[model samples]
Target: MGVTGIGGFFFRAKDPKALAAWYAEHLGVGAGPYGHWDTQAGPSVFSPFAADTDYFAADRQWMLNLRAEGLDDLCAALRAAGIEVITQADWDMPGVGRFARIHDPEGNAIELWEPAG
Candidate 1:
């Protein structure tokens, strides 16, 4: 049978328990023993970039993108929490969506997207 969807994402962390707690507090993720996060149904993008692509930091191998709603409020909340939120007008497309960037405590790149209505 064909693959249904991504089952989970596993990554290494210097402090697994602390990192899990951080994700739960900031991004509302990794809520259980196995780090199960329930998400709303929506379009999921799976694309590979070229080795020299400049979309994100060159030193990083992967970037995480999360679908969002009420992005303005969320970005504000994230900034108020002292988490840096990166936004640029050029990164947004007219019909596609708006995007903001942030990093985890471990310095992994994360993209937040709110698709256009």
Candidate 2:
């Protein structure tokens, strides 16, 4: 059978517990052994970029793109929590969506996307 959707995302973290906590506290991502997030139904992008791509940091092997709603408020909350969020005018595609970027405590790149309505 064909794959249905992404089941999980596993990664290495210098401090797994702390990192999990950060994700839970800031982005509302689930943490702990039984933590699970129930996401809304929407489009999910799966693409491989060129080796020299500058879409994200070169040192990092992957960037996490998450679908979001009420992006403006989320960005504001993130900033208020002392987390830096990066946004660019050109990053917003006409019919695609608006985007913002942030990093975890370990410097992994994460892109926040709010699809065009």
lDDT of each: 0.90, 0.93
Q: Model 1, residue 45: what's the lDDT?
A: 86
Judge candidate 2 at residue 5 and give its lDDT. Answer: 89
Q: How many clashes (backbone atoms < 3 Å, residues ≥3 apart in a chain or on different chains) does model 1 have? A: 0
| Candidate 2 C-alpha lDDT tens digits along 1-117 | 998888888899999889889999999887545658888889999999999999999897899999999999999999999999999999999999999999999999989999999
Measured against the true structure, the TM-scores of the candidates, in listed sequence, are 0.94, 0.96
lDDT of 2 at 10: 88
lDDT per residue for candidate 1 within 9-72, as digits (tens), equals: 8888889888889888888887866899888887888999999999999998899999899999
- How far off is residue 4 in model 2, in Å? 1.1
User: Which candidate has the highest lDDT of all?
Assistant: 2
Query: lDDT (0-100) at residue 62 of candidate 2?
Result: 94
Most accurate candidate by TM-score: 2
Taking all chains together, the TM-score of candidate 1 against the true structure is 0.94
